[model samples]
Target chain A: DAGVTQSPTHLIKTRGQQVTLRCSPKSGHDTVSWYQQALGQGPQFIFQYYEEEERQRGNFPDRFSGHQFPNYSSELNVNALLLGDSALYLCASSFTVQGYQETQYFGPGTRLLVL
Target chain B: AQTVTQSQPEMSVQEAETVTLSCTYDTSESNYYLFWYKQPPSRQMILVIRQEAYKQQNATENRFSVNFQKAAKSFSLKISDSQLGDTAMYFCALKRSSRALNFGKGTSLLVTP
Candidate 1:
């Protein structure tokens, strides 16, 4: 089975531009989450989507949003991006099961450079 | 929300040697999960080991094991017989009912020959 896959492995955009990163979840998985990792820092949770709805979110601003498609894929969008938006965007997917601990599997992240 | 802390910013080990990375977390929720993820140059976060809060026995996966001290809120990862491929940025994370993770700053581990 193919693991989680992210598109546009590397992207470069100027400040105030919009960017969208795509992620395809692993086979048989239904939950998708997005995270941002700054240089030399751990990932910061952006948001999580489940069942085509946002189920949880972190401290990110409204400019950062996400969507979960019916096929369990996800997209993270950042509008009017600033230079600080430059970071590695990571996508993780997990199988949600009631009463079972979920282990998240991640994809090789998309590196976004905001100039 | 949970807060995870990885104290060691960097660590090194000789090939075939062992190294331990320390982590502590603060959380009010009794039901939670802890995890160690390794990110090499490839940039994919790979789960090395995991432990559930209610489980007293430590969690182990081959060369990787966790020393989970619930009372102290400490979870340390120990890698035995380390190899050059073990070099990576190791992250400690916590997750509650929301399923969103709180990650630590991470410890950069280097295993040299």
Candidate 2:
């Protein structure tokens, strides 16, 4: 079975520009989550989508948004990109059984660089 | 709010040897989860092992094992008989009851042959 797959392995954008990253969740998974991993730091949760609705969000600002399709594919959108926004964006998916105990499977991630 | 910490930035071990990476976290939730993920040069985040907060026994998978101390909020990973293929950046993460994770800065492990 194919694991989670992300599009555009690497991306480059300029300040004040907007960018979108895509992710396909693992087969048989329903929930999708996005994370940002800065150099020398661990991944931080950005937001999570379940049933095509934004169920929960992290500490990120309104500039970061996401969407989950019926097929469980997800897209992350960043508006007004900043140089600080350059990081490895990871997508994780998990099966929500009985509403608890989540084991997330992660994608390779999309490397974003804002110049 | 929860936070994970990995004090060691980098560590090196000889092939066939054993090494341990340290991690600690702060959380008030009674039930949660902890995980260790390995990111190799390929940059794929692979799940190494996980420990549930309520489980008293540590979680183990093959040569990978964890020493989980719930009271102290400590979760350390031990890799036995390390191999050159074990080189990677290891991250410690915490999943609260709310299901979002808080992660540590990560420790880079290098296995020399």
Candidate 3:
């Protein structure tokens, strides 16, 4: 039983460039959500993907987008990255059946550094 | 929009002692879920414990427990017999229905032996 897994443990990008981070949700899970944790701060929700479609989003702008594949894996894409985009990008997974009560298991997270 | 707040930025406790982290949240929804997640130096978010709005009994997991006050909108985590491994950044989060979790700034706990 593998937990949620993320690719490219770390990434480095520059302004105006785009980057894509990958995530494989825990086995038996379907919903995937992305979050950004800045230095010395808690994670802020980026968006959520369910049924291969974006279900809910946070205060993030259009530049932040995500996709949920049929296999329940997910990818978070950030376009035109800014220096402020540097943060730890976290992926969490849970089953929709339990709804809000479902415990969300997280991955190790990809550390993104925007220059 | 719902919001979670952790007033304490940092706290310290000696090994084998107990420590409590404070959290407060604002939400109009009568029914929701509250959670405490611990992120250590490794940066993995680990669920410590959770409380349901409708449940009167506080949630507990091993040495970790929560004091949930629905009317006061307060949720505090108490760690007993703390160890060095207990040191981490603890975040308080709130969720309603199918919405994404709203997390507080977090409180950094340091356990010293």
- Interface RMSD (Å), each candidate? 2.1, 1.2, 1.8
Q: lDDT values of the candidates?
A: 0.93, 0.93, 0.93
For candidate 2, lDDT tens digit of each residue in A19-46?
Answer: 9999999999999999999987899999
Worst window of 10 by summed lDDT in candidate 2 chain B: B1-10
lDDT of 1 by residue, B1-113 (tens): 33899989999999999899999999888999999999997888999998999999999999999999999999999999999999999999998865688899999999999
Model 2, span B11-91: residue lDDT tens: 999999999999999988998999999999899999999999999999999999999999898999999999999999999
- Give the range where candidate 3 chain B is weakest over 10 consecutive residues by summed lDDT: B1-10
DockQ sort, best first: 2, 3, 1
Candidate 3 Cα misplacement greater than 4 A, ranges: A98-101
Q: DockQ numbers for every candidate?
A: 0.70, 0.77, 0.77
Q: Provide the lDDT at B63 for model 2.
A: 96
Model 2 residue B31 CA deviation (Å) reads: 0.9
Residues A1-115 of candidate 1 have per-residue lDDT tens digits of 9999999999999999999999999999899989999999999999988899998888899999889999999999999999999999999999888734278899999999999
What fraction of the reference interface contacts is present in each model, in order? 0.86, 0.77, 0.97
